[model samples]
Target: MSDREPEVVRRLSSYDVTRLDTAITVIQTRDPALARILKAERDVLRDHRNQLDAFATRMKFGSAAPWHPEGVMDWLIAQGWAPPKGLLMAEGEQEGQVDR
Candidate 1:
């Protein structure tokens, strides 16, 4: 992954299903393995969304937004990719934080 957002991921996140299908088709041509991995990732996200739906019901709130279970860098790391550490820090740069 680059410093910039992954365009395929962006398109997959789009509200339009046609765009998502097109993005998936294009991504498969470039990196078939990654496309498969992302499909699995999407499944995981969908499962989390289901859980969040239940959570929201029990808590009496609106449906919660879908979220990744781990950080972006964590996913990259698992993929054997190393993203720049400085970019991984949260806002305000809390003191004494070394490796998270």
Candidate 2:
């Protein structure tokens, strides 16, 4: 690996990352095969986001952190790793919203 790897990756626009993130959501509820495809995509996106954040830090991009997926709970639930009904944020709530 060359030191230029990060510079090459830094070329990835925020929109590119955003599209990957959106794609994950779009396919998250589809057929098992499609959902499986997104699982790998999300992993790659997550790693890319991590690398971007590190690159930003090294370059002192700004006070703002680089973008990252904000769908941990949703992704986990979709993968059946988290409770289907939802996480028990409270006795009568799922993720802090009361179940109706």
Candidate 3:
């Protein structure tokens, strides 16, 4: 008989849910290449989230820090990984005229 242990899959933490959802959406509709990159990143994030959850579970009874849903989103935004939404001026450098 082999003594190999069974692999355990960790559940996604509350904080990770939003990021995963957003990533899935962006990947599905947008660039497949970017999606592949995001999938790899998501795997890493999932691992971190699992570790954090485990740590939180072990410490005391209820002393876990509140998860920031926008944390990853903000990071992606800052990296300019995706195009800007809402406001649009021009493709290149061009000052916009203020409408009053």
Candidate 4:
């Protein structure tokens, strides 16, 4: 993680589903296992917080967003995927720091 702002923003925003395939392509190149996890968890990411918290922190969910439980959820929804239910977020959740 550059721990750099603009690079972080770029990485975080790359998760937008509009560019998801491309992003995952990049992900696959870097970490095939995490890419597999991402493929498996595409629509149901929020529930696996512990493993996600661990794996994600290892994988660096962008190397951008912090992978705390809520932060992981934050990244999920920010990617343009709908939240499962009841966890709907307010706008501007992406204003904070993140990396990939």
Best by TM-score: 3
Model 2, span 1-100: residue lDDT tens: 4556654444555676577667767777776677677767667766767765764564454334433222433444454555646343546554445546
Error of 4 at 93 (Å): 49
Candidate 4 per-residue lDDT, tens place, 47-92, comes to 3334445545644644554555666666666655587764654555
Inter-residue clash pairs, candidate 3:
none
lDDT score for residue 25 of model 1: 81
Global lDDT of each candidate: 0.56, 0.57, 0.60, 0.55
Worst 10 residues of 3 by lDDT: 62-71
Stretch of 10 with least lDDT, candidate 1: 61-70
Clashing pairs in 1: none
How many clashing residue pairs, candidate 2?
Answer: 0
Per-model TM-score on C-alpha atoms: 0.35, 0.37, 0.38, 0.24
Better of 2 and 3 by lDDT: 3
Q: Mark the regions of model 4 whose C-alpha exceeds 4 Å error after superposition.
A: 1-16, 43-100
Which of the two, 1 or 2, has more TM-score? 2
Candidate 3, 1-100: lDDT as tens digits: 5566636645455667578668778676768877777777787877667665655554444334343333444444554547457444456645555556
C-alpha RMSD of each candidate structure in angstroms: 12.3, 14.9, 18.1, 16.7
Candidate 2 regions off by >4 Å? 1-10, 61-100
Model 4 global lDDT (CA atoms, 0 to 1)? 0.55
Task: Give one digit per residue, the lDDT tens place, for model 1 in 1-100.
Answer: 3588755433232244344456678899899987887677666656555554544454444224333323433544764667676656588775467865
Compute the lDDT for candidate 3: 0.60
Candidate 2 accuracy as TM-score: 0.37
Error of 4 at 56 (Å): 33
